[model samples]
Target: MKFADYYEIMQTIARYGHALDAGTAPFDQIFTDNVELDLTHAGPPGQPGPVIKGRQHVLEAMTGSADDPHTYRSVLTRPALSHHTTNSEIVADRGDEVEVRSKFLRLGNSQPGPMPILIGQYLDTLIRTIDGWRISRREVISHGP
Candidate 1:
């Protein structure tokens, strides 16, 4: 792929953050039907843990968890410490698909609490379907409590 297209792909990957800024649902739309998030890699969030599958499942994870006062407020708006910060791995082509990995980090803090740092990677598999480049798989690995 040319440099321009490569940049475009990276931008699309980063766009997930932009949409999260404007969206109430954090990551549902960012993932595809076949996508699955293995949050166990970072342990669970207790009841209604955020590990989810498919776009709808991920959507519910974001929306449903927002019922808790703490979680709701934490996510209703973007965390103060986190913005759109990401570093992408070299994009590799796999026939009609592209394999991409990116390191993501964000910071968040709450009243009467210590400011926490969040870091993660988006392991993505994008495919060039009839609709053009679309995320076919996504795995989120986070380093945070």
Candidate 2:
């Protein structure tokens, strides 16, 4: 991949963390309309994660439910949440698309300071569109049991 492609891909990944931290939805700028979000590896020790398809569904998943406000599903609604990414590897590089594997450390502010929340891996496939790189599919895998 060219330097620009690599940089842009990383930027795309960075944007995810920033968006979450800011609690903003830049859907069209970050994902494709037919995006698939697979959180099968993000559930409890052995529980199955929810697999959400379509952009609107993914948006709803991120927005989460108001009734159960403290659940992981409502993480986006929490304040002072941070996501840091590292070990971004380009798994495949096509002319117009690329696959990336990366690790993230999620932290949340506590009375003492920032506390580790979850360590996870992001498996993403991004495509170059008129607007720039947009994630078409994303699978989140948690490192914690």
Candidate 3:
């Protein structure tokens, strides 16, 4: 694969973190319309969350609950002071599609001091679309302390 293609894929990963942190980018722009999101591993033990299908549902989940004011306020304010890092490796490059395995880390000042809130690995499948590289599937596997 061309270096530019790899760079674009990296940018897409960065955009995912940026969108989550800022809540500024629309889900459709970063992910495919029929994206499959597996965040089950992020849930409690023996209680993996359901595999979310479609972009709208995924967007809603990531944006937090609108019915609860606390959840809404927390999502909007918490990540603003955080830093995100995505250490990604291109595991497969098929010209039109690419698979990346990434280590994701988030550090924020939500507690006494800046500390890690999450450490995880993302298995991402990206497709080269007319708009650019967009994530088609994402499986989040979180690391426990």
Candidate 4:
């Protein structure tokens, strides 16, 4: 019900997005000690899947170099894809903590013949710690059929 709180949440979301966009692992300041992420991503085994429990686990699932040899070799993994969030709907509120549902799109990756275009929504639970607001649990739902 407060504009300041709304702005803070928005900023927090933007920071997370920027971290991923810059292809850098998000610092520990944005996690709730036990951050959980259910990523609907793949990268040919020993590379990707659902990572829960720690932010480090999520980082391994996401962090990579655009100039990496393997990525450069893979036709499907080239050209790259970026994610954008929209239609954020705040579903639950607990004072400084809340849960939001939003639609996300993986835009513009031309490589990977059959791009696993991610067009889906996420249910993210966020909390405000002593540092700031952080993602507590985020459940991903990828579209199919």
Best TM-score goes to which candidate? 2
Single out the weakest 10-residue window by summed lDDT for candidate 1.
66-75
For each candidate in the order shown, give its overall lDDT on alpha carbons: 0.59, 0.81, 0.75, 0.62
Please state the error at residue 108 of candidate 1 in Å: 1.5
TM-score list, all predictions: 0.68, 0.86, 0.84, 0.72
Q: Kindly report which residue stretches of model 3 are placed more than 4 angstroms away from their true locations once superposed.
A: 64-83
Which 10 consecutive positions of candidate 3 have the poorest summed lDDT?
Answer: 65-74
Per-residue alpha-carbon lDDT of model 4 for 1-145, expressed as tens digits? 4777777776666565555555444446555667888764432335456556766655544553333311222222234555677888778888978988887766655545435466777788888888777888877776631
The alpha-carbon lDDT assigned to residue 2 of candidate 4 equals 79
Clashing pairs in 3: none
lDDT for position 56 in model 2 = 73
Decoy 4 TM-score against native: 0.72
Error of 1 at 93 (Å): 1.4
Score residue 60 of candidate 1 by CA lDDT: 53
Decoy 2 TM-score against native = 0.86
In model 2, the runs with Cα more than 4 Å from the true position are 65-75
lDDT of 1 by residue, 20-133 (tens): 554543342345556676565544355233556676655456445533212233243454645454778757786667888888765567786635466767788876655445
Write down the lDDT that model 1 would get: 0.59
- The lDDT-based order of candidates, best leading, equals 2, 3, 4, 1
Model 1 residue 79 CA deviation (Å) reads 5.4
C-alpha RMSD of candidate 2: 4.3
